[model samples]
Target: MARLTVPLVLFGALIALLLVGRVTSVQAQDIEPRAFSNAPIGVNFLIAGYGYTRGGLAFDSSVPVTDPQLETSSAVLGYARVIDLWGQSGKVDVMVPYSWLSGTAESAGQPIERIVDGFADPRFRLSVNLLGAPALTLEEFRDYKQDLIVGASLQVSAPWGQYDNSRVVNLGTNRWWFKPEIGVSKAVGPWTFELAGAVTLYTENQDFLNGGTRAQEPLYSLQGHVIRGFRSGVWASLDVTHFTGGRTTINDTLNNDLQRNWRLGGTLALPVDAHNSIKLYASSGVAARTGNNFDLIGIAWQYRWGGGL
Candidate 1:
């Protein structure tokens, strides 16, 4: 029975690991599962991963590029720790990513292309399960079973990536962004159902497109997941997400590029042993209103320690 609990605890790391593969800011569309899951207190996780994304640049609609397609390869390093918040289960995690991209498109009826490589923005997140999950030690967790859990999270993107105002195709946004989310998770037998909602807000980019100031409206998103868990501690999930409302204004001039998009994704997590796990994931854009779409695939390896294991 103790062996059954090992992989389950590491499921939460998939949120940060899979997220590192997506686009940035308003173009960032992702599907995550097991976000509200629980783990023993004092557990630490180290993860290293690689991903490849193929899709349109999905630039802020204000840009006049057309028929844009890009292929990007990225790598990320991440860390997470489970904490105790007044008996409630809590987590804090961070990820840093680097990427290389090559693409081509047409702007104003003229052909354009770019190939670049550099560090992308880094993200940090804090999450807390407000109900159902408890902060238990490894010994106490052996008997724990999830019922219904409610959780909240806040994630921030720092503008510390490689960016140049002179180039339209750079690896960084040179702006800060924030996302606040709330979610619920319910377990029935070996199946879990999860739903979450979030809003992403962006700060002004004073140096966009060579000293051009850019601002964007808030983007709202909703996601759902269905998961199946096996006794061997392996799990698989089906995920879907929809998002809308991210129009941009450059130099105080508003643009009419409101967005509506849908995405589908899947995840498979396998625990090799008590301390190591591997995850494979893929996502694709199903529908897009403003020409923003992408198909992404990635893999990650996680190692766990502490928690008195």
Candidate 2:
């Protein structure tokens, strides 16, 4: 029985880690499952993935002349470690992404095309369980069962990507952005429900196109997911998200690029063994008032190691 409990606890922790890999930042609306999870401390995970996206960029009427289209492909790599903080379960992770993009747009009644390839801004996240989850060892975790969990996280994007002062559109945002989020999850039987809310704040870009300062208002986002677990360490999720209010200004001139978007997506995870898992997901914009109207598909591989410390 003791030996059986160890493998069960380890498998549960790995499933939670694989769910985290599904929440990539490749799109504006990130889909997350099991945001407030209970896993034993001192576990580490490594993830690698690829994503493809095709969409149209919606521009303000003051700048563009016609329809614009964009297609992008990216490679993602990340590392995560679970620890104990203040007697509670906590995690810290980092992600780096590189992308190649090509697009066409019409300006001044003429069609223009451009291609760019470079690294995008990297992201770091720290999350802590605030309620209903405590730091536990492997043996102690064996008897634990999840109920209601509340968690909080802070995610930051560093402005270290490829940026060109001369280009109007580049792979990088050229500014720092961060989001503070709170999440709650409840489990009943083999199903879990999760909801999370966040607001994204951006810093000024001093080197905007043609040497102008660029600023944006705060963006508000809400996300929800319904997840179901199956036999053999398999899980699936249905997810949705909405975002609004990110009006941009360049040199004090307001742009009509406020975001009011809704998206829907789903994810599936299959476990090959105790240490390896695969994730597949796809999402599309159901409604878009501004920004990009795109569809994205991604697949990831996760390898986990380490046990309780």
Candidate 3:
């Protein structure tokens, strides 16, 4: 155990330093592109952003609500680091979000409304390139071109946000979730194509609303992206996603709410300088499962350093 102390301390310090730098990301219904791309070891990222949504805001689609007319404004900070893992390229990252939500909905045939603000669940991820990417320095990374890369990642969302047992709509779920995913990225000329599949498993929320216990089945998701890159350090992508199968049970009573939803979005990233970049993104639900219809638009700024840069 003593032999592991130094490495653990170093890793903790690394994450602390990056968190002090600030960063950003989205959590639910995630549709991120280039998530598995390789980067030079030791490179660090700082991202900060804000997002606005109209219609609904439920971490799980089966929130037992109907005809929701809601809006959410979210602010997030995130950080990421590239590391060398067993001669392969890997990354560790985290994102935290704070949200102000205002909404109205019908529950059990009663009209309800709430205006609330608080921190949302934070997410952390660890990813490693399994094939077609090797650990490299900045110099080696400059001359490298990607063809086919396969990667795997695990993402976790912790129950660190505010939750009210009396309110049906809140910023937190009072539960934990894990997502294990595998992805493939292929670069073709100036275009890149990527696909990912994941399953999100949830733990029971013991202190659910009305002092009842709540449990959910796993949710499965698949997403695809088509990206175009230019020589001017600007890139864009079209994204689509489908997720299904999150049936909820409350107090031994099974709810008829099962989720099958689809969303479409796009992202544009423009590099302003060697250390600064800007990103614009938008997504809309094409098919929603009850309390899951929403439209989102967001913009973020990113800063990169280290890795001898």
Candidate 4:
């Protein structure tokens, strides 16, 4: 036990230092793009290393129960590209994400906890923008001093990760899920506000683990930001999610009981260059099953570069 302490402590300390630097050097609300020129083709990449502190289970109508603190972490990478349209003002963007999860969890009264490590399910999303800004705008609409933009998105979860088939923290569900959503954005002066919502259609999971079931899911998000000026901005965003639609079937019998969960978080962004940015965020659950309430702290560095010829 003592032998493992040094590495874990070092990792935690490093992340802590980064967070401190992010918080003290600048305020999250002051980053912004100086110009809105559309590029013919563009690419963006994001890398995030996250830590999850609490681990527990929340069942229908039951308070959450915590066994032990399961220190888990994931390294996620995403890539997106813009498809040129007309010039650069309008475009289509598609992104893919891959991640790895590792950690250990212990029960409250249990003497020991188990180690968890595996690849996460891959995710894909596509978006198409209409009436893009800073590139092309209808003369009539432009006169209204309105920065209206609309888009649609489709996302899918592929069951391509490693799975224990009996544990809750597996990489794949062994079943596929998909979602469709619409988004709207507007800019007023130096502020930009966005709203998006989606619904998930769940498929049957014959081998669902931990007495799990398949169900429909709903997600909604709202983000608002004010760019104090170019290259700096303070932004606030909130997201809400709900899960319910599947039956708890045990031994071919249905247990009408359903499970639900939710999360909310906010972040501040600062640009280090034309293609690089830094963000600091803190999140926690408001109301959740007893074992479901936990807090999260994170920092992300993003870079946008390269694109199609």
- Please report the candidate that would top lDDT against the real structure: 3
Candidate 1 lDDT (Cα, whole model)? 0.77
Provide backbone clash counts, one per model: 0, 0, 5, 15
Q: How much is 124 displaced in model 2, in angstroms?
A: 0.5
lDDT of 1 by residue, 1-309 (tens): 766565555543332232222222223676878777788899888878877887765323334356778788888888888899888989888888888889987764778798988888888889899999999887787688989999999999899888889766667778898999999999999899999999999999899878999898999999999999777667888999998998888898887678788899898888676677778888888898876477888888787788886
lDDT of each: 0.77, 0.77, 0.81, 0.42
**For residues 1-309, what per-residue lDDT tens digits would candidate 3 score against the true structure?**
866755444333322222221234454788888878877789888888988888876454667778889888889888899999999999898998899989899888999998999899998989999998899887787667889999999999999988999988888888999999999999999898999999999999998886889999999999999989776556788999999998999999998878899999998877665667778888899996656678888888777789877
Best by TM-score: 3
Q: What's the TM for model 1? A: 0.90
Order of the predicted models by lDDT, top scorer first: 3, 1, 2, 4
lDDT of 2 by residue, 7-77 (tens): 67557645554345533556446777776687778878788888888775311111222465777887988
- Model 2: worst 10 consecutive residues (lDDT sum): 57-66
TM-score of each candidate structure, all chains considered together: 0.90, 0.90, 0.91, 0.63
Candidate 4's residue-wise lDDT over 1-309, tens digit each? Answer: 865755444332222221121111111111112112223235434444343434432111121123434444545445444454543343332222233333444333334444655655555655555555333332222233336766565666666666665554444556666666665666777555655555555555566555555333332322233322232223334433333333344445554334444555555555554345566665555554334344556566655545421
On a 0 to 1 TM-score scale, where does candidate 3 land against the true structure? 0.91
- Among all windows of ten consecutive residues in candidate 1, which has the lowest summed lDDT? 17-26
How big is the positional error of residue 277 in model 3, measured in Å on the Cα after superposition? 0.5
